[model samples]
Target chain A: MAHLAMATGFLLILIGAWGALTNRNLLRMIVAFTIADTGVNLVIIAVGYMRGRTAPIIDGAVSAADAVTRIIDPVPQALVLTAIVIGVGVTALMLAYTYRLFEKKRSLDIRDYTDLKG
Target chain B: MIKRFIALALVVAVGSVFATLLFGYTPDADLNLTARYYAERTAADLGAANIVTAIVVTYRGLDTLGEVTVLFLSASIVGLVLAKGTHAPHRTPVPVGELLTTGTRFLVPLILLLGVYVFVNGHLTPGGGFQGGAIIASGILLLLLADPLKHFSHSLISAIESLAGIFYVMIGLAGLFLAGGFLDNRILPLGTLGNLASAGAIPLIYSLIGLKVGAEFASILAALSETEEL
Candidate 1:
């Protein structure tokens, strides 16, 4: 199960990287980046998974006494929480930039903008 | 064509590295040192039902604070970049169908309520501030989708966000002064485990984080919606 999830994550990252590298439209590139971001999160989750354990929550089903043997790693869960929130914020910023670029150039294509101010 | 081939080659190389890592990786039979420490002590040290909540709200709270600051910065930057002028665009929005408008009205209140529930009970359940905050913002999103021209008070959203952020910091400072260290959960009497009020100030901190995050997201959504040509 761990390897499967890890492989899927790697596939997603690769797909996202491919799309971001080849896509001409800024919007597509952003979408691709998010895919890659999702993959990174997934890989982290997979790395933290335990074979026979459940979630990290200390509930009735999994008592606090035996939590050491019962629960999956909580560190990765916390990291993923922060990552997902930051991902949203980053995506929002990306969209904002995309909107600005669109407003200025009236184009979503990346090649339209010239960097040389001279 | 050459650029595309190069991109593909790079992707392949990266994928090969990933494959190697995946193949060599063996799932840990035992919790690592840090994970074991959290698992063993989080309950007694924090009295939080959710171990992850304990880690996020208190154990590694400084990182979470920085995380929220990053979010605030992102939201602020987006709002700043998008808000061109005080006046909104004057274009009339096409009427959304009755199904969406009515469904949103019926569903939005429930979603907002659920968001509150999630964040308020963050200490015990799987959900926490960020999840609840996103849920609340989703409700706002639904509202905006129903009426594209809907104008939410920017000041109100900012006020909520700012107040929540202030209180969050104040609570952290309180931990610094009253408890073990900064963002410590033991200040407010850890309470009984698994109960509603068990995890010291986790619920309070999480609720604040939820409100702050929700307001930031709502403001961002409002800013973006306002920017729409419709």
Candidate 2:
């Protein structure tokens, strides 16, 4: 399951990168970047998964004494939680930029805004 | 066509590299030293049933604080950049259906309750402030959809945001003065391990985080929606 998730994450990132690089629409590229962010989050979370292990939450089922053997890594989950929120923040910022760009140029196409291109 | 081919080639190369890395990865048979330490010590040290919460709210609390700052900064910048665009001509407000408006009015409180529950129980459960904050934002989003012309009071939102942020920093400072270190959960005595109040400052910090994050997201949503659709 972990391997499958990793593969899926890698595939998503590739597809997102391709879309972002080749697509001319600024909004579409932002969406693609978000997809890639999701992929990265998935990959980070999957790296912590271990077979035959439960979550790190200690309930009646998983005792503290046996938690070291039973629980999966907690660090990655914490890191990924931060990463996911940061991803949303970045995506929102990018979207704001996209909206401002559209407001100025009245165009969504990246090719239309070549003022910064050398 | 040439651009498409080049993009595909780049993707293929990157995918192959990741694939190789993925194939070589083997799930560790045992927890590493740090993981082992956290697993063994978390309950005794923080009295938090949720190890992830222990790690997030205490062990690496500074990073979490920085993450919240990043979110706040982004939301603020989004609001700032899009603030000028609202001066453009306003579109005629579309009336939402009666059912949708009523349903949203009915559901918003419940969603708010759920968000509060998730963050309040951050020390004992899988969900935390981040997830709960997003939920609250979704509730605000529903309200926005139901009333296109409804103005969310910016003062109220900013008040909640700033208060929660100030309280969070205060708690961190208090920890520095009274406890082991900055953002230490030990400032308050750890209650029973599985209880709602077990994790001392974890629940408090998470709840503060929830409020700040929810307010930030609502601010962003309001900023985005306030813009004139071009």
lDDT of each: 0.94, 0.92
lDDT of 2 by residue, B1-230 (tens): 88889888989899889989999999888988999999999999999999999999999999999999999999999999988745334678788899999999899999999999999999999999898999999999999999866678888999999999999999999999999999998898899999997888999999999999999999999988887767
State each candidate's chain A TM-score. 0.95, 0.97
Name the regions of candidate 1 deviating beyond 4 angstroms: A116-118, B228-230
Collision pairs in model 1: none
lDDT string for model 2 (A1-118, tens) is 9999988888889889998999999989998998998899899889899999999999998998999999999989999999999999999999999888888889999989999889
Q: Could you say which candidate leads in TM-score? A: 1
DockQ of 1: 0.86
Error of 2 at B69 (Å): 0.4
Question: What tens digits encode model 1's per-residue C-alpha lDDT throughout A10-89?
Answer: 99999999999999999999999999999999999999999989999988888889999999999998999999999999
Deviation of model 1 at A25, angstroms? 0.3
What are the DockQ scores of the candidates, in order? Answer: 0.86, 0.89
Instruction: Residues B13-126, candidate 1: write the lDDT tens digits.
Output: 998899889889999999999999999999998999999999999999999999999999999999999987754566778899999999998999999999999999999999
